[model samples]
Target: TQLLEQSPQFLSIQEGENLTVYCNSSSVFSSLQWYRQEPGEGPVLLVTVVTGGEVKKLKRLTFQFGDARKDSSLHITAAQPGDTGLYLCAGDKSGGSNYKLTFGKGTLLTVNP
Candidate 1:
């Protein structure tokens, strides 16, 4: 099992505030994926970084993958109540044909208006 750790584990912020969450692992991955999940719902894929040192942005959210592909981070420009949910980082340990995804425990974010 891959050891992926997400910092803070939990985050609580007011609406319009900015925040960032991080994911790190000792094992190098072929690709990384970020997902957000709401209560009683499956995680929704937000972004995927297949190349090292890649950066992706979705609206007010920014995602960055480390050059070594061992770490990643997500930053939100302005927190919103609608953005409150569980953020998960997944790493594809086995690339290509044998794709295996290892997931982090996740970071719980609560944005209050």
Candidate 2:
């Protein structure tokens, strides 16, 4: 089974702080994606890092993929109340009828105003 485990299942902090979340797995995947979901809306794709050891930056967020393609990490430069949401890391495997993604349980982040 291709399962991705995320660390710090829950996090709470004051506004204007920094935090890093990790996702690790024993299975290899073709690509990894990070998403942030707000209250009612669906998860929004934050970044997608394909190459091993690859890193991508989006505003105040940085995402990195492991060299073995089995792990990934997300670092937020300065978290805000607006950043409060569910952070999920997903992996895309090769075999699947549709573009299916295996999502982690998710890390719930709460940024106090």
Candidate 3:
């Protein structure tokens, strides 16, 4: 079975602060995706990384894929109170169907105002 480990299961930071969360695994994946979820709502996909060493940025958020495709990282620059939510990282096994995704335990972040 494929498994993903996310670091710092929980985090609390004041608004405007910055933080970085990590996701790692022993197995290489064909693709990886990041998502953010708010209470009472499903997770919203943030970005997807397929190529090794790929880096993607979305406004204040940045994502990086490991060179070996076994890990990923997310960096939030100047977090806002609105950014408080559950962050998730999911990986797709190399040979699995497109819908088959293995999700990490998730990291809960609270950005206090």
Candidate 4:
């Protein structure tokens, strides 16, 4: 079984501050997905990076997949209080619908207003 290690299990920053969270693994993945879970709610899919060295952006957020496809990161520019949530990274080893995903413990970020 493969494992994805996430850094900085907890984070607290004031509004407008920027932050970056990372997820890494020794095993290669076919695709990697980022998710955000709000209090008392299920995780929401943020983005999916399939190609090595691929980068995707969502407004003030940027996602990057490492060239080795063994890691990824999420960067938030000028973060807001609304962005406070549990940021999780998941990796998919099998490129199909019938496979399970390995998840990281996640970084719990609290953006103070």
Candidate 5:
């Protein structure tokens, strides 16, 4: 299996709708970071969850880290055109060559206004 993966790959929703994107991995990670990117721009860190079963909320978005620290999820309470962007989940190993993060291919979310 791929070390890390994201479901749906793509999601399209109308404004005011809700959606959840999932990230999974077979190997455990020391930490995980979620990032969002708009067109032509680099991804901006939304949050980082390092503890098992930890949850973090930001405005309309919520992020959760798996109890095993091997997976995570992002939930958008209400969709908006401004929410359209690329969502990425990255696992941080933080030691030796493992310090580099392994990213999920990415989830492309489009919210129609």
Candidate 6:
């Protein structure tokens, strides 16, 4: 089984709406990262949460790490057409040695203008 599971594999909303995506895992991770990817491009990191119970925000996006460091959530307010993309969550368990990331399948979001 995949280490990370993302909910709402796909989402469709109108501009100005709000949405939330979730990533969950039963195993603990040293760090978790959120990324957004556009069509024909790679995923760009949006936020990285290393500390448990940590929260980070970027513009209209909010990211939170679970207190146990096993899960994370992403919230986006006032969604825009530009916000449409593939949202991905990845977890790192390397003890500062190998830099391998376990990525979730990804959540696809589509915002209609």
Candidate 1, which segments miss by more than 4 Å at Cα?
none
Across residues 6-109, which tens digit of lDDT does each residue of candidate 3 receive? 98899999999999999999999989999999999999999999999999999999999999999999999999999999999999995556777999989999
Off by over 4 Å in 6: none
* Segments of candidate 5 deviating more than 4 angstroms: 95-98
Give Cα-based local distance difference scores for all models.
0.94, 0.92, 0.95, 0.95, 0.92, 0.95
The total of clashing pairs for model 3 equals 0
Stretches of candidate 4 off by over 4 Å are none
lDDT of 1 by residue, 52-99 (tens): 999999999999999999999999998889999999999998888665
What 10-residue stretch in candidate 2 is worst by lDDT? 92-101
Q: Which number leads on TM-score?
A: 6
Cα lDDT, model 1, residue 108: 98
TM-score of each: 0.96, 0.93, 0.95, 0.96, 0.94, 0.97
What is the alpha-carbon lDDT of model 6 when measured against the actual structure? 0.95
lDDT comparison, 1 vs 3, better candidate: 3
lDDT of 2 by residue, 11-100 (tens): 999888999999999999889999999989899998988999999999999999999999999999889899999999999886445477
lDDT (Cα, tens digit) per residue for candidate 5, span 1-113: 56889988999999999999999988898899999999999999999898999999999999999999989999999888999999999998763466578889899999998
Task: Predict model 1's lDDT versus the native.
Answer: 0.94
Model 4 agreement with the true structure over 1-113: per-residue lDDT tens digits = 53999988999999999999999999999999999999999999999999999999999999999999999999999999999999999999987874799999999999999
Residue 18 in model 3: lDDT: 93
